[model samples]
Target: MSCWDTIADYGLRSLGYGERLLPRSDFTLCQQVVLIGSGMLWNIYFGTLALIAGFVMATAVAMGKAARNPVIAKISAWFIFIFRGSPLFIQFFFAYFLFLSLKNAVPFFTVLTSAWAGALVVLFLNTAAYSGEIFYGALQSVPKGEAEAADAYGFGGWKKFRKITWPTMLRLAWPAYTNEAIFLFHATTLVFFSGFPAQSQRGDALYYANYFADKTFNPFVPYPVLAGYFILLTLVIIGLFGLINRRLNRHLPQERRSRMQMRMPVLR
Candidate 1:
């Protein structure tokens, strides 16, 4: 088949839209690229939904960690510790089986046994814990002078937090949060690799790349294509986050604004 035909046939195979059977022999470069790109739809699905849900949860978690009440503070702290302290791979392993058990007991949890739901819950909690810590640190680091200034203006409670505290906390936390967002997207590849099975052979980008590698007995081609797709994805993330970063710092002088620097974690 021509490249265009390959595109038409497999462009959305990962979503179960086009040809159901994967190419068995005489694999062409077009098939590899199109099928792999098709699989990226799942990566985008997991990452986008998890990140959006995590952002709201992370905000609540940060506030809980910083609350005046000891009970709330301790609960939040332990939540962060448990998720952050364990390896994510182990979390996925445990979560899948845990959900499976729940599914057996409660019919409502049947949906959670699937990778789409089960894997998403794992990613959502994981990113929320990490980001909650980041936001908590930023909350603490909010300049005391800013708080005092708010007090001077007779701002108190919700109004003060909304106008003064929250914006400043976001400004301070955004650079690090951008990094977390990037990492979250990268982590989506782990979904199918974990205990959660990809439904009906509709797997993510890494899943298809692994297939091609196993069939061709050549890791060099398909793996690199997968990497290339992720690299492009990373660039798109950086560009979009950079725009938000600039918006956050717009009120400040250029030199005084916090610039986003992408720093890879030494260990994660």
Candidate 2:
């Protein structure tokens, strides 16, 4: 096939369109790019959904962790500790088996064996834990003076939190939150590697990249393409977050607004 024909055939292959079987031998640059790019759809879906859903839960979790009630605080702390203290790779395995065990009793959980449901849930919970910790620290760091001022005007309870607390916490947490988001996107690469089945080879960017590498016995080509795709994805994330960061700090003077920087997670 010509380059354009190859692109047309495999462009959306990851979504089960156009090409049915992947190139088995004599891989070309066009095949590598098209197939890998198609695979990116899963990564984007996993990351975007997890981040959106995780943000809401993370906010609640942060509040719970910061609550005056010791029981609430302990529950939140335990959740965070369990998810964060262990590696996410382990979480996927444990969660999959946990779901498997529950599936016999709760048939609804049978779907968890698939990367779509199970891996997404794991990523959602994992990101929520990481982002929750960031939000919790920001919540605690909310200026006491802001609280006192709200109190002077009789703001308290939900009123004080809604009007005076949440926005400030978001503004403060956003930078680190952005970092967490980038890391979470990077983490999506790990999903197929976990116990969850990719099912028909429909997988994320790294999955197809790995497939090509294995088939061609040439890591140099496919891996760099994968890396380039991720770099672009990272830049897109930074741009989107930069817009939000701008809005978060809109009220502050330019000098006071924090600049957004793309940072990689520190691996141990």
Candidate 3:
């Protein structure tokens, strides 16, 4: 089959639309590319949904942290500390076990044992905490003059915060937010590792890459193909986030505003 045919046949195979069975023997580069590209859909799903959802939660956590109220501030602080202090790998393991135990304790908790529900929960919380910390620092640096300027314009409380404080915080927090976004994408590889079974042999890019490596006793081909796919994914993510960063910094001087630049990839 032509490469286009191979891709079309298996591109969305993870959702079970194409070839009924994966290539078992005589694994070719065509099979690997098609299957792994199909797996990329799952990575994009997890990363995009988690990051978009986490954006709001992170803002709330950061705003709560910067609030004058001690109780609200403390809760935000502790949540951020708890998630940030530990390795996400440990968190995923612990979360899986905790969900498993919860299922044992309460029969109604089976949903948490399902990877779709459980892994998303873990990632949602994890990214929220990390992004919250980034935003909190940015909020703190929003400048007293900006706050006073809000007051001078007869703005107070939520109005001042919603308009001035939030925008500025986002502007200052954006580069780091982009970092959090990329980190979250890398973290998507951990979904199957965290007790979330790949139902029906359906797995993410890494999971399939690992499978090929094991079956063929060849890591060189499969792993590097996975890497190339991920590099492409990363570039796309940067391009998307770069648009947002531009909008966020639109009002600032070019030299002072942060541009989205590639940095070290964060592997979970």
lDDT of 3 by residue, 1-268 (tens): 7888888888888777888777779889988987988888888888888888888999999988988999999999999999999988888889888988999889877897877778888899999999998899998999999999899999998899889999999887887778788889889998987678888778888888988998999999999999999889878878888898898888889898765656644523
- Global lDDT scores for all candidate models: 0.92, 0.90, 0.86
List runs of model 2 lying over 4 Å from the truth. Answer: 261-268
Cα lDDT tens digits for candidate 1, 32-101:
9999999999999999999999999999999999999999999999999999999899999999899888
Strongest candidate by TM-score: 1
TM-score of each: 0.97, 0.96, 0.93
Candidate number that wins on lDDT, 1 or 3: 1
lDDT of 3: 0.86
Q: Which candidate number has the best lDDT?
A: 1
| Residue 132 error, candidate 3, Å | 0.3
* Runs with alpha carbons beyond 4 Å of true place in candidate 3: 105-107, 253-256, 261-268
What is candidate 2's lDDT per residue for 242-261, written digit by digit as tens? Answer: 99999888999989887875
